[model samples]
Target: MTRCDWAENANELMTRYHDYEWGVPTTDERETFELMTLEMMQAGLSWQTVLNKRANFKVAFADFDVTKVARFDDNDVVRLLNDAGIIRNRLKIKDTIHNARQLGKWHAAGKTMNAYLWAFVDGQPIVNRYLSMVEVPAQTPLSQQISKALKKAGFKFVGPTIVQSWLEALGILDDHLATCTVNHLSK
Candidate 1:
């Protein structure tokens, strides 16, 4: 089973993530929010770092529960900052809280993060057939558009690059390499 080049040399966790989760479309609200929050935490950092700390993040951010995270206070912020297992960036932590609040508003309005995001692609994943990771772009016009929309909708720390990664992680944008086994699986 040939994996994507990036995953081939990855640690066990990343290898598992690539094989089972990456590029797999999901509509679960908690999972969607979790991936988005992880992407936000990944700004200026490698995906490996995020994956490495995912377990810690899940614990620190209340299992990525939208309502729970949205209710997080400054006390929670202080707690997260002192956690050595996860990234300790204060702005990212606060933005995750802010984004969770935005999701809370969406929930109150009878909307879902899944619906709002999948709507951008007309309810289908955008499949890309790149042969190598090098062909995968860091950001694209679609990401820029989504970033603008998310920001306008009250989400923070969601710039184009982060949005692009989030989209990929959510399987809204399938970027599996053509030669990778998961490429066929995602399709």
Candidate 2:
């Protein structure tokens, strides 16, 4: 099947994520949290690696349950540190919990993760018409704005590039290349 250039050579795991999951708009709170968390884990790493370890992450992080992950404490940190199935980075592990707690608070305030995230682009995905991967940006002014907002809310690993990737993955910003077959179909 014709695909985005970045996904063209992807392995089975990455291929499935690209074809079935990436850039698909979701309104589910859990789903949104999971994608955003995975994007955080992807900092300084490859998407392939995150894809490969996703199942393990789900298992280790209590299926990405915001309440459970938010409740994670010192013991959880030690446990995650010893878990070889997921990324062993201390900062990432800690930040996952931190973000989860923040999410929990947001939920308590009646804010759904998907809804809050979609507000960034006015609840519509921005479909880019770039013809090539090289034309896609690593960061944008919009991304900067989002990153700033996320950091203000006490999230970590939410740099401009990381937030941009999260936005793309969540379908808040569709980055599929115009030359890519999926670009037209990605929505």
Top candidate when judged by lDDT against the true structure: 1
Per-residue lDDT of model 2, residues 1-187, tens digit only: 5788988887888777777677777777887888888988998889888989999999999999999999999999999999999999999999999999998999999987788778877888898868888899999998999899889988888999998998888878888777666533443
> Candidate 2, 87: how far from true, in Å?
0.2
Per-residue lDDT value at 39 in model 1: 89
The TM-score values for the models, in the order shown, are 0.96, 0.95
Locate the minimum summed-lDDT window of 10 residues in model 2. Answer: 178-187
Report how far off residue 69 is in candidate 1 (Å).
0.7
Once fitted onto the true fold, the runs of candidate 2 whose alpha carbons sit more than 4 angstroms away are 183-187
Enumerate residue pairs that collide in model 2: none
Native-referenced Cα lDDT, model 2: 0.86
Error of model 1, residue 107, in angstroms: 0.1
Cα lDDT of model 1 by residue, 26-140, tens digit: 8999999999989888888888999999999999988999999999999999999999999999999999999899899999999998998899999999999799999999999
Error (Å) of candidate 2 at residue 179 is: 1.6
